[model samples]
Target: MASSAAPAPPAPAPPTPSASSTTLSSDGIPTLLTIPALGIKAPIVVTGTDPDGVPETPPFDRPDEVGWYGRTASPGSQGASVIWGHLDTPKQTAVFLYLRDLRPGAQIQVARDDDTEATFTVERVATYPDDSFPSDLVYNDPGYPALRLITCGGGFDRATHAYLSTVIVFARLTAIGSSANGSGTGPS
Candidate 1:
């Protein structure tokens, strides 16, 4: 004889913030991201979060591009701005492969659609298991401008087909400058 019980319900999805939940700058669309120390320069695209609240990243075919969480605060806005990249693709190292190598005090410059640049100074680098992602620290509004650069790190798991850990680079807003129609200083 079998028990006559219904299957358990699935867990609720993570919260997805509204566009108005965070302050958005007039030129919030990030056009480019450059990390001088890593010699990385890539175009940026706005990506939405999945139903589980995990940010969507660029497709494997677009390995050279980075993706910003579209619903989150803008890079220079009053919250934790997030950007992610693939560490590697099937054939080559991807856009953020060296993100974990960034040291505190390194510079990250984001050029926006309006031709202005937001500069950030790296504060810390941390690696955590994928299951132990720190949601509050990574996504909450910090009451000031901040940036988080994330990429796959640690070892690869053949069994799960995923990386064992995620590398996060936390940075603080340092300065904003005019890029003069995308011709600003810094790498192209």
Candidate 2:
């Protein structure tokens, strides 16, 4: 029988903007996240490290929202911004179930609270065990605006029934405003 469980990655590169794309000053408080390639459009929620110092995730009850690690730079800002979601929940597939499928050049859009929307382009995708997560790469400043979308993947230990790895999609700010249609990769 097929396993009924969630499975479970990192960075980016220099941004190359097309003539029609308008690059913005790296900054914004993201309120929404949209990935056309996965047909994912979800609200963004702010989350912080737990008491034990591990980064917190979105609540399981609200699987529809993506968690923005509040300690990191805001999305589209001149630093790394992290957003993550559940790959799947016991009751249903969650918002980021397909996060592992994102390929290079995929586009992600963030509607920010600043009355502006920032667009990002996927530069790379990766997966890593939860114990070996690249915290530096995900949390360190890239000296440019960057976005990291993460979800569970890798091996699932039957004993725990939890995914052992995280899938990461790293992208850099490519443009801002209405002109950034986020038209690169369509839904798979």
Candidate 3:
């Protein structure tokens, strides 16, 4: 007899870094990510993994907070930079609810702490069931510097009463600009 379980979704395509991409060093922590198309701008704090190997989740589990993985690629670096947030709350909108509406070629800008700015272009938007999330391919890919903006998707399962999918926006860095004085800072 055939099994009733659904097959796992295929892994996401490998990210391709643009020719103009740049690598960020230790000085580039605390980058700011802005999506003009979506009218979203927020500061990113560099953090490390907790004991359970999970990166910190802030502004998701708690509002009014910002955090990013310190061990991962900095905003301008040539690897995947993973950022996540919640979908909704009991009262307010969450950071990434609008992320699913982003189309290919949407503009995403990152301003480094040193005053440099890097711009990226969204390439795709995909949704995956939460049970079979492609974590390794999404977060561990080494081919190019990528950005994954993630949030909950799909309808809330009446049985579980929770969202069943994850919305992911894939983007690649395409432009970099430095401060006139070479300080690598930019206007907030």
From the highest TM-score down, the ranking of the candidates is: 1, 2, 3
How close to the true structure is residue 28 of candidate 3, measured as C-alpha lDDT?
67
Report the C-alpha lDDT of model 2 over 1-188, residue by residue, as the tens digit: 01221112123332333233233443456788989999988999998766555667888888889988777767766677889799877677899888888899888898887666778899999998777878778877776778988888877777777788878889988866642443432211
lDDT of 1 at 87: 89
For candidate 3, write residues 58-134 as lDDT tens digits: 54445433455555566666677776666665456666668799999997877777777767789999988877877
Which residue pairs in candidate 2 have backbone atoms (N, alpha carbon, C) closer than 3 angstroms, thus clashing?
7-152, 7-153, 8-152, 8-153, 8-154, 9-126, 9-127, 9-166, 9-167, 9-168
Error of 2 at 114 (Å): 0.8
- Tens-digit lDDT track for model 1 on 1-188? 00111111133233334344222363467889999999999999998756654457777788889988776667876667788898887667799988889999998988888667888889999998767777678877665678989888878876666787888999987777675643333222
Relative to the unseen true structure, what is the C-alpha lDDT of residue 102 in candidate 1, on a scale of 0 to 100? 98
Give the candidate number with the greatest TM-score. Answer: 1
Each candidate's number of clashing pairs is: 0, 10, 8
N/CA/C clash count, model 1: 0
Stretches of candidate 3 above 4 Å error?
A: 1-21, 60-66, 157-161, 179-188
Q: Is candidate 2 or candidate 3 better by lDDT?
A: 2
RMSD of candidate 1 to true structure, Å:
8.8
- lDDT at residue 26 of model 3 (Cα atoms): 32
- The TM-score of predicted model 3 comes to 0.74
